[model samples]
Target: MQVGIFQTQEAAADYAAAHIIDVVGGATDPVLGVATGSTPLKLYERLRAAHAAGTFTLAGKKAIALDEYVGIADDHPERYRNVLRTELVGEDKTGLTDELLFTPDSSAPDPQAAAARYDEQIRALGGATIQILGIGSDGHIAFNEPGGSLVSRTHVDVLTAQTRTDNARFFDGDLAKVPTESISQGLGTIMEAKEIILLAFGEGKARAVKELVEGAVSAKWPATVLQMHPKVTVLVDEAAASQLELADFYTERWNARH
Candidate 1:
């Protein structure tokens, strides 16, 4: 794992975006595993800027969403699929057609069956070439909340109270409107990605960032599972990296590399 503690969130996004552009440009057929929420908004913006500048194009690349809310209308503005479409793709965005963005079917009659088919689709694409992730304040990644099986696959998982509260802002700050469940990619599935880029910012994420970078690998902190992956880049601002005991070491290494 490479931990990059940047002075600001924008700097971190710049680094992450450059790495993503390189990965996508180098791959013959790149499949991006993307995340939703506020933390990744800047990164997506950088990617769009890069594309507009002709630095790299995402025209034919495939993008697989990490999770989607269950029990929400397909047209819900806060739905993961709709969020990705507005933020990353479409005629006015990154130019990737709607057909290229694959998301779990949360509206299906059988959500479990939809999840299974989503997993198969990922496998058929030979897994994600690079996955962009954002850690929840509770250390959950892609809605694989704490205490769940670390090796589980695509499946429906209940969202914790903390998660729902955190996501309430997306639902107009109405906690009751937030979906209580979601179809999320399991740690086992995320681990299959050839590379991973995790972004966390703000003081709220400090403890989780510390656990993910310096604590033991355990299901209790689902983000910690990434510690076992061979190629993982953790990018954070000082506030988010505040709890990391080895912050100086990570900073020293990153500085020396540059």
Candidate 2:
């Protein structure tokens, strides 16, 4: 795992975007596993800017969402699919095409079966070449909340109370409106990615960031599972890296590399 502690959020996003460009540019047909929520917004913006500058293009690359809310209309603004469309592939955003962006069917009659099919689709496309991730304040990743099976596949998961409260802002600050369930790629599925880029910012994420980078590998802190992955890059601002005991070491290592 490579931990990059940036002094500011924009710096962290810049590093992440450059790393993504390198990976995508080198791949024959890159598959990007994308995540939703406020954490990745800056990174997406950076990517869009890079594309507009002609530094790189995402025209034919495939993007697979990490999770989607259950029981939401396909056109709902808060729906993960629509969210991705607006953020990464809307009409004006021409880098990634709409036809190639994929998300789990949240509105399917049978959500579990739909998740299974989505998992198959990922496998058929050749697992994610690079998976983008964001850790929840409660240490969850891709909605694989606390206590979820470490080796599970794509499946439905119940959102924890903390998660719902955190997501309420997206639902107009109404906690009750947040969906209780979601179809998410499991830890096992995410681990299949050839590489992973995890972003976290703000003091709110300090505790989780500490656990993910320094804690033991356990289901209790799902993000800690990344510690076992061979290629993982963790980017964070100072506030988010506040709790990491080895912060100086990470900074020293990063500087040495540069």
Query: For candidate 1, lDDT tens digit of each residue in 1-258?
Result: 999999999999999999999999999989988999999999999988987888877798899999999878989998899999999886456777789999999898898998899988888998899999999998999999999999989999999999999999988899989999899998899999999999999999999999999989998899999998999999999999999998999999988887
**Candidate 1 residue pairs in clash (backbone atoms < 3 Å):** none
TM-score of each: 0.98, 0.98
Task: List runs of model 1 lying over 4 Å from the truth.
Answer: none
- Residue-level lDDT of model 2, residues 170-226, one tens digit each, is 999999999999999989999999999999999999999999999998889999999
The residue ranges of model 2 lying beyond 4 angstroms of the native Cα positions read: none
- How many clashing residue pairs appear in each of the predictions shown? 0, 0
Residue 118 error, candidate 1, Å: 0.6
Candidate 2 clashing pairs?
none
Instruction: Estimate candidate 2's alpha-carbon lDDT, on a 0 to 1 scale.
Output: 0.93
lDDT of each: 0.92, 0.93
Backbone clashes counted, model 1: 0
